[model samples]
Target: MKVVKRLIGQRCLGIEINARGELMGLQVLVDKKDNVVLGEELTGMNEIQAFLDEHPLTPIALSVSSDEIIYSRTDQQLDDQSMSDLLRQEVPSFDPEDFLICYLDGFYGFARKEAISEHTSALSAYADQVVLLGFGPIPAYNLALTLREETSDRLTVGSYQFDLNDTDVQEITPQDLEVGGLTVAAHQVPAFLVAIGYFQGGLGMMGYPFAKNDENLWYGMLLNKLWKPVLFSILALLMVNSALFLHFNSLNQELNEQSVLMQNLSDRRATLASYIEQNRQIARLGERESAFAIISDQIGATVPAAVTMEQLVLSPQSADRRAESAYQKEKVLLQGITTDLKAFSLWVNRLEGMPWVSRVASQKLTETNGVTRFELALIRHVEES
Candidate 1:
């Protein structure tokens, strides 16, 4: 007999239920020959909510047992109707509505409706996608079918046997045994069966796999497997968009407020610029009026009675609009005749005591006729900028 090679890239999550009904998962890898069970792993069943949170994408295959599975056999060849009637007779407590009956060449299988619903629900909680749903010890029998071809003589797993000569499958007391240099441990049979069952179910050979669903394959798979991922993806995308919209709106409001403030400050600065020159001219006039008053009082207080002024000249330069100057200082020139030089000298010394006089000098001194003639020039103190 020619052996078909296993699809090398094929892999699945093989799962079985414990006595507590908790799931035990194994990662199975397929090679050219038998399917390999790599190791046991922490199942996503208890952590179903977390799986939905983080990894809503991994596929799952489950070998579940929630129903009362009854085995029956018919000696006469049976049609679909007869097989259904025969299965009911074999398990009297079974109802057609609550249970689905499966027949494979006169071998009958029965499982309750509620059991399948519960099993698939539990599987979806762990994975959004259920790649395959298989029931009872069927995957084990699926393995047995493959092993029979490999051994060629007789192959056994626990109490189940895969015989080359016999068409019918049978069960005996399970034990650990070595066949063709391979040791089949009793405890390892369940996991091994699940992996082989998943492997064969994926292969789609002759369709009499351990579990068979003749009618509702498409509806059952779509409702359980693909719905959740599509729904969750949409919701997460909407939340991100909403947050971004709010952040942009806040920045726009702040930008508008700053623009208004900047425009107001620019208008105020333009209005103040027109009055700049007017303010400077008025301020300069006030300072010159105060200085002239101080000078007049000092000259009258220090002048000598013997001196008679022939001429007096005070020249004060005004702020020139063309030069754009803020203010200009004043200078003094006096011409007088004195009967005595002693009086003239005394008068000059007293003028030096005034705050505004920086320097006093006699520009001319001469004896003409009966009186002495003199010319005096004065420099006024100017404030630094």
Candidate 2:
């Protein structure tokens, strides 16, 4: 056996090991100030025994693999009976009132029965944490009953039971409680602690699924393990979604309001347009009234005593009419005495020369009952000046 030593003060200690059982490393626990506290090593029982022997007075502690410590001598046999026999040989002797012992295993063989019976006398002296590995139907059932009596208040067994027959090594089952309030088979108490970051190595090496059987309980534990961060994430997502929904809803409402406003504006614009058109028509009617008045005054002033106005007509220019003729001519018919063609011509010329009249022409001249009548045309100007 090779021995390595490092002096360190009080602190939590850790050890690492490789697959091959060899002492490969050693270190002293150091703080930020480079002060040493605990010592660590990757070594076996020989080194541990030596260290303990040398530091008999000092409070020395050794961290061991849960599996390795419990099943150290039985690795080659692999059978429950053989492993039980090995445990009987290797397990430390117990002293009642000073120690307490509890076994966790899937089954018990002959050796387990002997070990349990022998250790029962000093079970109280054993540490709170003790476990056995392997599975058997008779052993499990028997152990369940025994644990009920032994660990009634301070300890429990198989409260959470893993199926010893399960090869997948993933299945776990919670133990059903009997008349007592104690949970003897619930593996969750230990496994849950591990998942929640309470326990790290040794007996806490198992993951959630391997330690719990109830799917809901398993999931609950997992969620609880990650509860803080998961809860925060869910809350953040809900807040973001709510904000987005509110924003879109507000935008929709605003759009609807704008649409209504635009519709009202459009209706008002249409009404205003109609009013403007009506006003335009009214202005045009007023201008036409003023033009008619001027034409009436000019016609009355231009007509001679020999000519009598029979009918006068005014109308808008026609599309088919010559542009100049349309703007400059108004049809007029006269029925009165005119001495001769010369007199008719003179009256026509005078009417044409009037400020508000033009384009005078005589289309007919007839003598009847010793009176001369003529039909003429004249143009009315829009503005008097």
Candidate 3:
């Protein structure tokens, strides 16, 4: 509260038309601690305007003469239409439109539009805002409440006076109280109290809203009202965005980590596939070696005493081709020297009759001296269906 008061740095120039028909003005300055510092009273409009010119930024509160203002108190709230009807009925001499009405805390104050205009115009040039404080000791009552001062049965302001018989009574003397370290007299209480209340920002409840003269000041008040909430909303949005960014950032990092893990698994899978293929190749070669051994043993056993074996080729490559001899994977080529042709023919027939032999075809036959050089293809036999 102190910091807020300091930031506002409010100064109120309270100009009251006292009961004595004298225009009295007092300027009250409220410190950061809400202490009231009162200025000496100025007697006329000239003096008040001069003081206002010196402090052009201050707000003014005009307390019109009690005779010119109509006030009423109620125990319940009244809407604008109801209040308007009441004001018209009470002051039948003038229309409700001619009066500026203000209601607060069950208290209503009505002032003639002309009277307010005349008072505000005199000081409007020097002040930013002007408020009607209305008639009576209401301002004084609020100030006394703020100071926690004991209430008296009666309170007076200049020639105007009012009785507080309905209020809870306390028998303390008004002289015993000290306001802002200054001793105040009983008669000066009303004016000084009003000024103090205005300075302390306590007059907002009782001030007449229609009395505020400047549009710029109203806009400024609106800005002050909207400022804090807007700032808080912006800050909240920034915090939400920051939190979302962090959450997504973490998710992205986790996804990257998962991708790396998947890549490693894929690489391992490829290596495993390569090893499996190599193992299959080796197993096929082992089966081929076993088949080659079995076939070579059968061929050697079929050889007769007259035939001397020279060379044998199984599944010979294309490079070993002889004239008119085409290579077949299932055929075995045999080359030998045979002294007796009949024995060689019987040997071929014997080999062909074997269960594993498909058929035997004679590829080449040559003779050199008494020895015979021959080439034969021994095709394996197939069983009849």
Best by lDDT: 3
Candidate 3 lDDT, 1-385, residue by residue in tens: 3344456655566777654556777676666566767666677878877776665545667665556666666655566766776666777675666776655434566778677666555555654467446455456545544443444646443333334434332323334236546766554555566566555453433224434543444345445756898999999999999999999999999999999999999999999999997987687568547767887788888799999988887766566567323445567888889999999889888887888777776657798998888898877643221
Let me know the TM-score candidate 3 reaches against the reference structure: 0.44
The predicted structure with the larger lDDT, 1 or 3, is 3
Error of 1 at 135 (Å): 3.4
In order of TM-score, best first, we have 3, 1, 2
For candidate 1, write residues 150-248 as lDDT tens digits: 666566665566454545566667677453455546544554456556555532211222233311333333444556877788878888788887888
Tens digits of lDDT, candidate 2, 38-136: 244424545644553443322211111122222211114234344434444655662222212222333222223333323322222212211221222
Model 2's TM-score against the true structure? 0.38
- The per-residue C-alpha lDDT of model 2 at residue 315 equals 42
Candidate 3 lDDT score at position 85: 64
Candidate 1 ranges with C-alpha deviation above 4 Å: 1-8, 18-22, 31-40, 47-55, 74-97, 101-106, 116-121, 124-128, 152-154, 162-188, 202-385
| Residue 128 alpha-carbon offset, candidate 1, angstroms | 5.2
Residue 153 displacement (Å), model 1: 6.4
Candidate 3 local accuracy as lDDT? 0.63
Overall lDDT per candidate, in order of appearance = 0.58, 0.40, 0.63
Candidate 2 segments exceeding 4 Å error: 1-221, 226-231, 245-260, 316-340, 354-385
Worst 10 residues of 3 by lDDT: 168-177
Work out the TM-score per prediction.
0.39, 0.38, 0.44
